[model samples]
Target: MAQNILINDLPLEIFIKILKEVDGVSLGKCRRVCKKWRDGIDGSDQIWHEVCRKEFKHSSEIAKRKAGNICRWYHIYKNLKMWIDITTFDKKVREFYKFSLHDKSHALDVDYGVLPLKDAKGVVFYDMSNLKYIPVAISETNCCKVTNNDHVSVILTKTGLYVQKCVDSNGVTEGFFKAENFVLSGEVIYFHNGTRAGELLLYRLSSQKKGPMSRPIFDTLAILPEGKFAVQLDVCERKNGPLIIASTFFEIILVEYDFFPHEQEPKCSFPVNKLTMYKRLLRLKDRLQSS
Candidate 1:
């Protein structure tokens, strides 16, 4: 006859090793088993880190950086898990609204509980919280696309790109060049300049103070191959830095902006200047065939 061993009797090292192999949900259940188990799980940051690594492989580092040094690993894990659940889970439609407008409305951009929609008159901000349309006066009637963040709204028209403060609509800053298409990620705008050379430009919304009279300026990032113009653009912040995904008629380009290296250096040291911030990671031609 042999005596049976209880799970609680296991050594701390062996216990943590076993818990590490379990999924996040299972780990949560184990933490509720008893005081000893909860303390054991919560005390080890490695367990939470491992959970985050397995759950959010692509965004773990980015989340950790945003959380800062004082934030605990468990809190970071919970926040990321919540965001994943909110974004990925499917839910039935609760309600819908029909709006009468002149001409077909352009693509709308939503951020921070506000959605900006472009109609015949101008760009109207639909407040998600209050359920009201606050029209922002835009002179350009032929608006192509509209996007915004918490700070400012960017309107792309056939003639030029316009940036206006979200609070004060009176001060509108117009770009010097015409853009075929553009994407707004936070304070940065990545756009395709409507030119034969297929030039991609970057405009920083936060750098308005650096320009004359506090106006934003454009920086030429990269130039695509001749005859290949970018029709669509997307930007996302990754562990490394900001990544731009641009799709042309024939090819898809992945460009990464390296801002971390320069950011890490001391402010007193001379800035490490580069020719261009755009670093092409991968270019796939005939994406449909390649897939």
Candidate 2:
């Protein structure tokens, strides 16, 4: 009898060590090298779960850049598909389990703009394409909002804030207020995409609850933006007001009224498109503060 020789077969222990260095998918691919490697792949389910979370974050970041309803649908679905492919176990990833990409697109923006994001709890993924009073909680079949502590806010349709407590899935809402006047900008609630002056309320903040009992309040930070441009500028703390963040074809004027101290008079005006004057005011403030 001739002695049999085998090659390209690394010990499972050795391959497991190597697998630790590579990602779950790559590890899955590595398993194809031989039966021994394939066996190790089964033990790495935790890696696959981690990959799922990473994919979700990556998809959220990508979705934020797109604008408008049509653009959002195009971008979000496209990216979701890409993320699905990123998984080694694509078949196991159900479409129903994943969130939609275009929940808060060009649907409704009273005054300001918000980008976009899928709806999730404990983490606000608001679309910042436009501004609205109600932070919409939506699905393809139904839509609602979580307004107050009860987590069962309902729409009044007549158009205005309606406040009341309830025991239901709809969430509590601030009902007795005006909608057109109560325009929102990421202040009280952290929408993943809306702009409220200079404040970016995206993190999970531990809020101190106040009133009757010192209960920690969890009402999402609601930064109501005064619909006027100059008003919004007043809220921004930048010395020259808010920095005009612009892109190639688009323009934004950050009103500086918010950043300048109440007693100080503006030395120069900053037009919506030009910002050179704003730079001087900032430098002047720095000098004054330093001196």
Output the number of the lDDT-best candidate: 1
Clashing pairs in 1: none
lDDT of 2 by residue, 48-117 (tens): 3344345445543333222212122223333344332222221111111123332322122211122112
Q: Could you tell me which 10 consecutive residues in candidate 2 have the lowest summed lDDT?
A: 228-237
- Per-model lDDT: 0.50, 0.29
| TM-score of model 1 vs. true structure | 0.35
Q: What TM-score does candidate 2 reach?
A: 0.21
Model 2 bad stretches (over 4 Å): 1-17, 23-26, 48-291
lDDT per residue (tens digit) for residues 87-201 in model 1: 2333222112223442333324333333444444544444332334443344444656655444445556676665544332246433334678876666677888745636666
Model 1's number of clashes is 0
TM-score of each: 0.35, 0.21
Report the Cα lDDT for residue 124, model 1: 45
How far is 188's C-alpha from truth in model 2 (Å)?
Answer: 17
